[model samples]
Target: MSKALSKRFGEESMDRIITWLEMQKISKDVALLDIGTGNGVFLIELAKSGFTNLTGIDNSSTAVELAKAIAEKEEVMSLKLQVADFLHPFPKLSQYDICIDKGTFDAISLSPDHPAEKRSLYQQSLHSVLKEGGMFLITSCNWTKEELVNHFSEGFEMLQELPTPKFQFGGKIGNSVTALVFRRK
Candidate 1:
């Protein structure tokens, strides 16, 4: 599964995230939330890296169940996996020190059911769940860095833009993915 994830989302992406966490001196026990955690591979990797307090939430119940099963098979007992929509506030969950989104924002942006409204709700819900001054690391394929910064400008300030693979197309240089780290205001 890890190998498959590495193939789907380059292994370097996960390495970069772990590296950034270490460079920022984020504690292993800090409350961390993985938004739209598909199969929980990322959380499992974090667990392997020694992050103890981790929670992963996905909108799909089946995804949550798969994550739970994978975590169990991997002997990762510390992960808390649940099915919850990121467009809504999670009343039962505590505010997290860090939140990571790989493709949730992009998916919401592409939804045909009131995309603009859903995007707004996503921001509100994310703000509610993430602590002030907390970190949000997001990786997106649909939006450029500037677009992402603009979308999150309301309550998040750009901290750093992580490196991703680039290509030349139509006499222009573009990145296949944009990974940005933002700090909640």
Candidate 2:
């Protein structure tokens, strides 16, 4: 099955994402990376919003295939998809203007019932790919907005917290959710 990552965060999240991207000051040609991207929802969405330069990475074989098919079917010419685990060591990145995650790190932040592990995992996994001053936006149900700010504060500057769209669950269900937008320092 394909991963649609229905964690809620939706269209209302775009203005926040786009605004954060602008503050990062990534050039028009800068590379945009979506880590733990499942089925390429944001990649396709961003492309339609005028961001043609993007790449999405997922650990699932099926996800990469689905994302590819979706990209092709959607006529998204610039989005690239690959398979890779976030926990494993990845080759160094020399470039990238932004990195976005829809809780891939949060998913890994589990410890057989331990919840705090996700914070550490998220910090390290994101460290490798995020360029100096690159932007980061993460959406999670595990931590409150304030907690997220403190967690990423070590390497990122708390830029802004857009009211993440609602979900059917805790916040708002089915409202195309909301996420914490940040800039790497």
Candidate 3:
């Protein structure tokens, strides 16, 4: 499980999120949502870490099915996995206290079909599903910290920026990925 998560989402990514959760003193019983949960590995990890109320959603039915299978195989069947598009109105689910997104915003930003509209809709959908003052943690390889802040500035405020690997190129150092936590306003 660790190897699969490390290969798909760098080990550091998950570690940093867990660290932040601890730093924030988030309760294990908080209603947490995993946005764009691909295979449900992260949800399983959260379950193993003692998070009780876990829900994951992906636009692809196949991905949701895969997540369900993986969760069952790992004996973490308490998770709620469903197919829901973030750019559209989400299905009726309870508002979450915390939401995590890994690479979903990056994919939406790259969409050629009305990228601006999709991005706006994504924010709206997220806002609709997350409670006021809810925390949103996102990890992206396609955008810088500054870019992400600018994108989500309207209804969200930056809380913390997680450290990522840096590379030096032409005497300039930059991060390969940006992980940010925001609070819904």
Candidate 4:
């Protein structure tokens, strides 16, 4: 599944993210956090793009270990991978300059019970970890741009909508994947 997703969304999705980062003119010294850093692919891409201050976290121990190994293999000296649950706030750490989510919310929302219970928690945690005016980027297959904007309406201003590959859907431009960036207020 990881390999398949990497092949499908790796280049195009990452290019969109890179473009957003460039537009923001985020310096290499600014802290970055990657929620649900599965296999650390996105962080690796950012690292390759000259992002120096990078950190990633996931609840899965296996994933954290894999991400650590991959980071080492890719020689990302400044990247840190840790095992963490995003639903809980991190009191020991400071706010980040940027926080990114790629399919993390989709996985959390897939829970059979109390799916939305954690959504609020995650939002609160994001608020806690992200500095004022900091950016949050999210990419998902489960939500449309409007849905995502509505979901994070409070304390955020929608900034940019990344382009997605549209297919013929009732004579409209429809896509399976959507990406958006928002700034905290």
Tell me the whole-model lDDT of each prediction, alpha carbons only. Answer: 0.90, 0.71, 0.88, 0.86
Candidate number with greatest TM-score: 1
RMSD of 1: 2.4
User: TM-score rank, highest first?
Assistant: 1, 3, 4, 2
The superposed Cα distance between candidate 2 and the true structure at residue 72, in angstroms, equals 1.0
Cα RMSD (Å) between model 2 and the true structure? 4.5
Model 1 residue pairs with clashes: none
**Candidate 1 residue runs with Cα over 4 Å from true position:** 1-6
Query: What lDDT tens digits, residue by residue, belong to model 3 across residues 5-33?
Result: 45756557777888889777899999999
Q: State the displacement of the C-alpha of residue 65, model 3, in Å, after optimal TM-score superposition.
A: 0.7
TM-score of each: 0.94, 0.77, 0.93, 0.93
Model 2, which residues run further than 4 Å from truth? 1-8, 11-27, 92-94, 110-118, 165-178
Q: Candidate 1 on 2-93: residue-level lDDT in tens?
A: 56744766466677798899888889999999999989988999999999999999999999999999999999999999999888766866
* Best model number under lDDT: 1
lDDT digits (tens) for residues 49-120 of candidate 4: 889888899999999899888888888867888888898856744589899998889888888879888887
Q: On a 0 to 1 TM-score scale, where does candidate 2 land against the true structure? A: 0.77
Overall local distance difference test of candidate 1 = 0.90
- Candidate 1, residue 124: Cα displacement in angstroms equals 0.3
Better-scoring candidate (TM-score), 2 or 3: 3
In candidate 2 the C-alpha lDDT for residue 41 amounts to 73
